[model samples]
Target: MDRKEQPLVSIVIPAYNNENTIIATLESIRNQSYKNIEIIIIDDNSKDKTLQLVTEQQKKDNRIKIYHNSTNLGMIGNWNKCIQMSNGEFVKLVCADDLLDKNEIEKETGVMILNPSVNLVESDTRLIDINGKKTGSFKRYHKSGLVKGKKIARTSIIWNNFFGAPVNNLIRKSVLDKTGYFDEQFTYILDFDMWMKIACTGDVYIIHELLNSFRIRNDSNTGNLIGKDRETYVAEHQRLVDKYAGELQLNRFEYAFSIWFRKFRNAAIGIYLRVFAK
Candidate 1:
């Protein structure tokens, strides 16, 4: 695609005290094969030098736009801020600690451009530790293609969030606008909830390739939620099942099974993360 013809993609990073990994994350986006992108970084009142480092990097790349919250909005609030501030054909919310492959945007954007019916495009993700070493992998589909939105929602409700994190997905801004903002009520499953909402509106395209690296740090929000507070995580997931059950046409048996299955799934994943993800 020509430089002028390529659609602008907004890469929004909701950063909070990610001083140790923010630069590397920014560099990954800066080096993307897709050039027509606007980097929106919203810092949630970090005590560290996250703002300063991003400011310096902004001088080097004019495409980067920085915003600092007056009061800390927390994770979900900061994410909603990034979505509101974005002005692009497609939006990607990449965590400050994660890294995207150079061709991540290019590939995901192409999929969306070719298929206007697709509201979201998600690819496989590589799991990396804080030190940036590959630990494991996260993938859902064995093949790449479009999946019905309702099908994904039903499957996800029964199983889990196979769509991975926000970094692994690209969403159409128009669809996102219709879907509305991320719900702040959700602490751990905010992205999962948003994905289900988007899937209800249109089809989802899945790419089997590992185009993003999700960094697993002990201090990250997910780490804290799943590691320190399993109760809240389970509660939020159960809430999703309840919220989507009727819309997805899940029967009482399916609904009951989903709730029970999630507990087992979470425990299995916790063990995997503890044993294999080391």
Candidate 2:
């Protein structure tokens, strides 16, 4: 069906100097078997030809809408604006440099609409190199299973993020409406914090499918901040553990680990880096 004839889904792509990969990213979403989509390309004051490229794509497809911020509000602020501008019943945030699997939205949305209780639908994702080449293997946090439907409880997210990043998930607008948007204060772990908050509202259902491609760019924020981000992530998480130590029995072990094991892991990383020159 044509986009006009079907239910619309607003896809927010926040771009900032993604000239190398943004075109491929938009193509993936455009090529999705699910035809009805309104892609909002919000330019975050990109100095590169990112805006120029988006403008060119906009002329090619009416379904593609373009918006530019007066000044760069960064990803968090731009995403908030995307949510405000969205007119779809469902919402999906696809980074300008990331690619969605052909059936990602159609598959995940079915799970949400069918399971009324499930507000968020997460799926398995694969990592790709900068050139869009497939990387080695499966993601660590998304446990392997034929789990057609499973809710992500608060415990699930905290444990996973403390272990790894949750990149390939499709969330409902309702979840965002209830739990609120990403915390801009957290430049790094915004998604992790938001997921934990979302899980508090209810269970996050996991649909076992290769839903999207997570790009592993060497120069990205995560890669750049790995050293400090790792320390900050652990410290902040340990702080959270301490704050909720009374309520969560699991926190008892976490607090203990915060003192001992978490430090040991950091020490181990230091040792490995020194030995391997990472």
Candidate 3:
């Protein structure tokens, strides 16, 4: 596709000390089959060669824009800074360690343009290790086939699906204006909060095709927060339930019970994983 014809895809990558894997991640974006892209890389005070490597690559590629946060703004602040700089109509919140498949942008972007009801579109991902070896798979809001709004709205099936990973999809820039960004105070569950807010606004579609490689690391937030993570997630989930109390189709007491049920189920999964040595 020509640069003028391609949808302006804004990729906000929050960088910390990803010196080893950042290059391959950005390289994947550079080789994207769908071209026109604005990449805003926020280097959040990495003591390693993360920013240095980007600067080297920056000189070679004009599409790569690098920003250095003076002190550590943390990932959330770095993420917000990238969004502020993006001028694209579509946005993808990619982690510094994750990678986009060669055709993911074209595939996901096309769906959103054709499906006006879809405010966000996501697809399945092939899981990988830091060494770029295939691991398993990761997906959020996945279904056997294409899914849309009313189904997404009636229940929290999507949340129950992948446990809530934000970058599983490409979101419209306008939706951010309506739903707001990640909750700054959340040490975790920022994506969960964002998804909850988006779910209430419009249809969120999950593509059946695999579109990216989501790297799985032991120390990554999701992996680290296993058994103990539910408490924090539960707190955030309850806040969403309360925030959209009217839309849940249940009274206050009923809503609380539902939230409790979901949390208990998540905790059970964590316990099982722990016992099974997964």
Alpha-carbon RMSD to native, per candidate = 1.3, 3.9, 2.9
Where does the lowest 10-residue lDDT sum fall in candidate 2? 145-154
Global lDDT of each model?
Answer: 0.89, 0.66, 0.75
What is the Å distance of residue 28 in model 2 from its true position? 0.2
**Model 2 TM-score?**
0.82
Write down the worst ten-residue block by lDDT for model 3: 157-166
lDDT of 1: 0.89
- Give the poorly placed runs of model 3, Cα more than 4 Å off: 139-150, 157-163, 227-229, 251-278
Per-residue alpha-carbon lDDT of model 1 for 194-241, expressed as tens digits? 999999998999999989999876567767676667778888888998
| lDDT winner, 1 or 3 | 1
The global Cα lDDT (0 to 1) of model 2 is 0.66
Stretches of candidate 2 above 4 Å error?
1-6, 139-151, 162-167, 239-249, 258-278
Q: Could you give candidate 2's per-residue lDDT for residues 1-278 as a string of tens digits?
A: 45565567778888899999899999988888887788988898999999999899888888898898879998779877877788776778878778887888788766766776666567767667776777633443354422322133334323444223333665667668776887666766666666666655654566555668777654676554443456775665565555444534455555565445545555554443333332
Q: In candidate 3, what are the lDDT values of residues 32-133, reduced to their tens digit?
A: 887888888999999999999999999878999998988999867877787788889899888888888888888888887887777778788877766777
Question: If both were scored by lDDT, which would come out higher, candidate 1 or candidate 2?
Answer: 1
Better of 2 and 3 by TM-score: 3
